[model samples]
Target: MCDQCISTVAASAGSRRRRLWDLPHQCHCPLVGVCFPLSTLRQLVNKALGGKAMADDYEVHVGAVSECLQRNRLSELLQKDLESRYASTVQAFRAAKTTKELAGLWADAVRRGDVAGAFWAALTHPRCDEVLQEVVLRDMHMLQHQAGAAIRVDIGKFNLLLREHGVLARELGKAQQRCTQLLAEKSAEIEQLNSQLVQQRAATIGKETRIAFLLQDLQQLRASLPDYENTSRLRKQLEQLAHRQAELETQNAQLRQQLGQAQRALSLRGPEDAPALASEPQQDPIKEAPITLHLGKKTVLCVGGRNGNLAHYREVIERAGGQFAHHDGGLENHQGALDAVLGAADLVICQTGCISHNAYWRVKDFCKRHGKQCVFVENPSTSSLSRSLQQIAQVP
Candidate 1:
């Protein structure tokens, strides 16, 4: 028998909360291992030996278990640490009024996988008996053997998971590389599309400029044709219409003067004279004024036409009672000043054949953005402008 066995033999039976020294000799080894970690055992043994170090962990554990067999420095330290560590568990066990109840708590604690705290608490419980102590010790011994087998099984599972993690990490790296490659390809495709769009826009502008030149050349060629019978006939009809318009205007003026004289004469006469005037043949009411261009106060801006024809353009606008402004469509004037001119005018007449492509688009975009009335004329002629103004007048 060892010192712990001798102590167990000498120990008296008691029905009270026992200290570590009062526990069975067999209980000491398991209790020391279960209730305390190796590091703590080392510390307690170092403290008990007064700073004298042990050769190995086993020796330290042995020393702690041996000290726990009696009242000593290591045992006291362990008692204090366990109480502090398992304070809540100790308080819970204190609720047990009988040994059978305390044993039930220990069994429940074992099923719940908390034997460390429950073991210490139950063994040191006030109602704990020798039979209850032996049962707890037996349960703890079987639990240790079961725990060793579980640790080996867990190690195998852990190794399998670690291998799976490595495979997943490699696949994730490959996926990221593929995504980056696809992004680079998409960026290249977008760049190509943008380049194509810019080229197409330039080509479109070139074609428009060519078409304008062709139209202007065609107009010049038609003007040079002296034998064009249609032109001569139209000119003659225009002269005849002008002459007839002048005669009608003169006749309207004479009629208005005569009606004014008659109204004055009637006003001067009495009520009896009004009846004689009614019996006389009544003169026809004057005809309503002919539909004509009337711009009121709105300004008309003419952009890009023959410089010599600018006076003709102004004359037509002013005759229609509209304010007139003009820009040379970036030919001689600054292109930057066009925006300000466009902003101030209420209407715009764009001579497409007479202007640069840049000026044409600038004027068109400005008119579109400001919601200005813009008339695009292919022929930059006085007759065309007059007809455009006449059309504007006819709109409701």
Candidate 2:
């Protein structure tokens, strides 16, 4: 019975020694470490109160662990779970943004676990804190660099879009200018076409008027055909009168021959008689005609004539005792001066073929308003001018 008691005491002492050291059952030996888990402190203290030998050993081990935990500031942090504490430290360290927050990263590492592992890792290892800090900083810098590169790419794309807009605007402006130019050209073409159409209409109206007048004259001639018997009697009378006119012309020629022979005989008798006979003026047919016209010192505006025939016109007009001025319509000089010349002239003569429509209307209006004579001639010749003068003189 005493042998059994001694064996049981030995077994209890061994178990108590293992519990005081808090050795993991998985540990190969009892000499590996002296620290206990902070979670097991209350149970160890209760067991430590039961015996004097274990109390001294437990106090020494726990006192050492408490001192380490305090030094690393892991005393409060050790109350939580190991995984929870590690996750909290890692999150705080990563969430740190400024230099002040990064300065506390060492403390976070020390508190990453209970005092045993945390104090040993931070205080025991030579370069562990520095390696962790370097890793975090490198990752942050990489993120920043990637963000900057993306922003630069966005700016480049925006600039390219702006350049494209400028090119498109320039092209649009050029197209607008081209459109304006084309519109002006089209408007001018339309205006020109309208002018041509108006001129054609005027010509058509004039032709229709001429045709009406011709038709009227034809009807009048057809109505006069019933008097053909009177026309035959008149034809017989014309033949008899023609014979009488020939006989009278022969008698007048004989009388002229006899008178010339007598005048020559009388002139051969004396120089005094010859002087008296020469002093008498010969009779001009134009001056002696029944319907003679003499434009003495009258101003004539000869509008629209050939410049080549100007000298001949002046000479002819001067011989007829008249002043002459001329205009070339609008072919050469300004036609504005023609109005002043027409205003000063007594007679206005226009060549229908050579004169412009503007000049013809101006002369016609001036003559009608001022009660002056105006004549329209087909040809701008000296003979035509002289015939017009003769016709105007017979207006009385």
Candidate 3:
């Protein structure tokens, strides 16, 4: 029973010390015979209850408190020293130090129905401290539990606010990025519009230039309208003149054939009619040449003649049994080709009026050096060249 009492006292005292004061929580006392010191325990109880006040009715409970302490083998520790201050003789009773002894004293006070005595007894003695500490600890635990619940609720609310802010920030970032993309697309569209505008301006400039040129041409055509009528009349007159010239050339060809037939008929009369024809009044001989031209297959170079009519001069010389080649007055033929033709010819017929002064001298000089015969034609006509060739043929 004594060992049991000590174990119970130590357990309850440990609980009160942990709950109420700054006592050593890890008690090293052996459970079988441990007796806690009342001297030090009373000091701890006074310190713990220093903030509490005793009422005037404490005087009436002093006798009951003293009786309980005496029955429990407890005694007051500072009886002599406290006699002067406290009106109650509380210092006279032995103090209960251990939890078991305080419990027994409390039970006895309650059995005697001394409620005031139990209250004062629990505060003043160490052994009764476990009874009072249980009530205080229970009230403190209830307040702490309420505070923890309020703090947890505030933390949860703050977390919800943070998550809402994070979501808003993400949405704002997406909106800004979308705005940037739209701005870039608009910039590209504007650049394309600018390029098209430039091309349109260039096309407009080209069209304006073409329209100006067409307007100028229209003005020139209108100014020349009178000249168009005059040119048409001249063109008709030129065509009529060309038809008259063709008719004249046909008549001249017929006359030439008649002359050729008359000459042939006169020649057919032969030597029997030659003396009679000579005895009569002398008429111009029908043949221009009295005798045949005696050019023995020799080439004659005609230098510097009228360009288109050179064929007439060539035909005249060739009909008189001579070969003919002509230069276009040195304007159309090279000087070396003229020189070569002049060197190979047996005679040179130079139309001095048609040739340049230099060409006349060149032909004269070439004939003088090469011992070739040269004849000068002042007027380059077929009749003049025929007469010159006729006079030469009549030479002995």
Candidate 4:
């Protein structure tokens, strides 16, 4: 249509609610561009053209439809579709009772990016005027230019972000691989430490077992001496023998002189005196013998003594020809065995200083009940044990 024809149409419509075909030729481009997607506009134009093929160019299609100033098949369809699509915007515009209020609603719609519905609703609004149309057109023109510049900037930023993302992704993959390698190395080290710990524990247990066995063997060897108690006594006897040797030699000389005197007298007194001298017995100088204690094979039970002196205690009883038995007085040995050991013993010797009161009582009670001999020795020496045995031996 020509500008005069468009001017005449605008003059004919006098500010009543206008239709899409009644809008000025300039309003067509913004309304068509904002209100419809390209694909939708293409379909609508194709359908309106009665299957006539439209050009593929977007501008070609928009230009062809923009010249529809009078109502036709295409213009009528577009008007119906816009009114239907923006019914709520139209109702909101209708609520504005003045030209100023309607313009405010149009500005608000533009700010909210709802220009499609607002543009259709505002131009077709009953309060729409020439001045409001010119203002809205100018605003839409500036907005299109700003949108183009923003699009170009966004495309450049998006490309930069794409390259940065690739670099960051490669760094993240390398970091994860290094973390996995460190984890594997740490796991191997932990396994090695655990193996060494197991070996050290095994060696420690073996050493402990060997030490216990050796300690038991040592105790047995200490208790195995047959004559340990006689060592000191024998040393004293040897010293006494050395002192008596001089006395024995002097006596031998005096006895030989007496014998010579007796022989001279016997020769003077003749054969009768010889028979008397021959009948008398001669004395020896070294006549003493060593004394030893004998127990006559009795089972002597000694309870409680110093652990180091246990060998001496055993040797004392054994040297006296007595069978030796002992208990550690509920210290190292079990207390339960005290009663059984007490029952089997012929004589009970208790070392009170080294024994528990319970074991002492048990020994005392057993010996008292059975009427067996019991000796409570305060000292745990071998001499005390020897004296106890001698006291028992002299009991008749």
Model 1, position 243, has a per-residue lDDT of 72
Each candidate: RMSD:
20.8, 28.0, 28.6, 12.1
- Candidate 2 achieves a global lDDT of 0.58
Candidate 3 local lDDT, 1-396, one digit each (tens): 355334444665442322111111111111000112334334423444454224332331232233222222222322222222232423322455565665565556555644333433343344444445454234334444655898899899889988998999999999999999999999999999999999999999999999999999988896868445435543653564466567768989999999999999998997989899989996776765342686776898888767546657767777767898666556645565567778889878888888887788889998998898888889878777777777666667
Clash tally for model 3: 7
Score every model by TM-score: 0.46, 0.31, 0.29, 0.53
lDDT for each residue of candidate 2 in 186-301, tens digit (9 for 90 to 100): 99999999999999999999999999999999888868785444455446545645766677789899999999999888867877677777899988667522326667889987
Poorest 10 consecutive residues by lDDT, candidate 4: 226-235
Q: For model 1, name the residue pairs that clash.
A: none
Whole-model lDDT values for every prediction: 0.82, 0.58, 0.58, 0.78
TM-score of 2: 0.31
| RMSD score of candidate 2 (Å) | 28.0
lDDT of 1 at 48: 72
Candidate of highest lDDT: 1
Model 4: which residue pairs collide?
none
Q: What is the lDDT of residue 160 in candidate 2?
A: 99
Candidate 3 lDDT at 185 equals: 99
